[model samples]
Target: MDFATPRRRRPAEAIVPMINVVFLLLIFFLMSAQITPPAPFDVTLPESENDNAARPADTLYMDAQGQLAFNTARGEAVYDAIAARAAPDTPLQIRADARLEAQALARFLPELAARGIAEIELLTGMP
Candidate 1:
């Protein structure tokens, strides 16, 4: 009787390792990428003839109804709300509606200066 050695079969390549690698790359990219800034709420930024490309600071939203909302909250006193969250050195950005009255602006602009915010930027859409 002749004796022959049986050949062992090789296992197929696994996709698990590839999937793990893909997931790891995705995680790495997500971690390394810059995080999006928080808007907290949505505002329809006003339109302007002149616009600058400079990156502005945290935004303040003012509705057409003369209501002040730092992002989304409708507070009793806008100054108090601002003072509670923002520091003296924090940059200020204002996003106000086109219908915002001058009196309303006068009420808060001086207060912002008094609070020691060095510069403030008003964001608007390009016309």
Candidate 2:
């Protein structure tokens, strides 16, 4: 009787190392990501045909009740904060609630101009 040679088995790939690498990548992305702060109040933006995407920089918020907020500043204090932060030429973005009056916005513009905000962009949502 001839002696049979023992069969050799190949080792399986190490899934544990792959899993560790994936976890490390997830951790890195979570740490490196920039998280945007929530808006101070809810705003229902007006619908428009415009498809423009707004930059997150230099934004002012106005609610349906005509209350204004800019960063940590609120109410009339927001004007002072905006004046301090805005340059004469840089356009400020206004995120106004849909329910806010056009007349109110008209009045608000002069206040901004008095504070030296010469230009502004009104943000709107797709209909």
Candidate 3:
């Protein structure tokens, strides 16, 4: 009887199910991520078709009672706090109620201007 060498068997291919699962998980996370807006106050900003630019770095708000509020803080002394917190170069966004008096706004604007605030934007409701 003649003796012959045994045939060598090739190893099986690696499983790809784990790779597919990882890819699916990545896609799920990407889709479920939340993108939040960068406003400190809950004021309903009036929208404009011409406003496709990014939001300003700082915000000031005047409520119905002619009271001023800054960012996330609530008080009448917000002007000084806002001036302290804002950068010298960043523009300030002002949101005032429709019924607010012009005299009150006039009184506070100069104070902001004196504090090295350059650009001031008045937010108005959409007509």
Best by TM-score: 2
User: What are the per-residue Cα lDDT tens digits for candidate 3 across 7-121?
Assistant: 6655433446677889999999999986545544445555555644657556677765667677666675676677688475677878876666779878878888777777888
How would you encode candidate 2's per-residue C-alpha lDDT over 19-112 as one tens digit per residue?
A: 8899999999999997887899999999999798987677899999999998899998998899889454678999999999999999999998
What TM-score would each prediction reach against the true structure?
A: 0.63, 0.81, 0.57
lDDT (Cα) of model 3: 0.70
Question: Cα RMSD for candidate 2?
Answer: 4.2
Per-model lDDT = 0.71, 0.89, 0.70
Which runs of model 3 end up more than 4 angstroms from their true locations? 1-54
Off by over 4 Å in 2: 1-13, 86-89
Q: Decide which is better by TM-score, 1 or 3.
A: 1
TM-score-based ranking, best first? Answer: 2, 1, 3
Clashes of 3: 0
User: In terms of lDDT, which candidate is stronger, 2 or 3?
Assistant: 2
CA RMSD (A), model 1: 5.0
On lDDT, the leading prediction is: 2
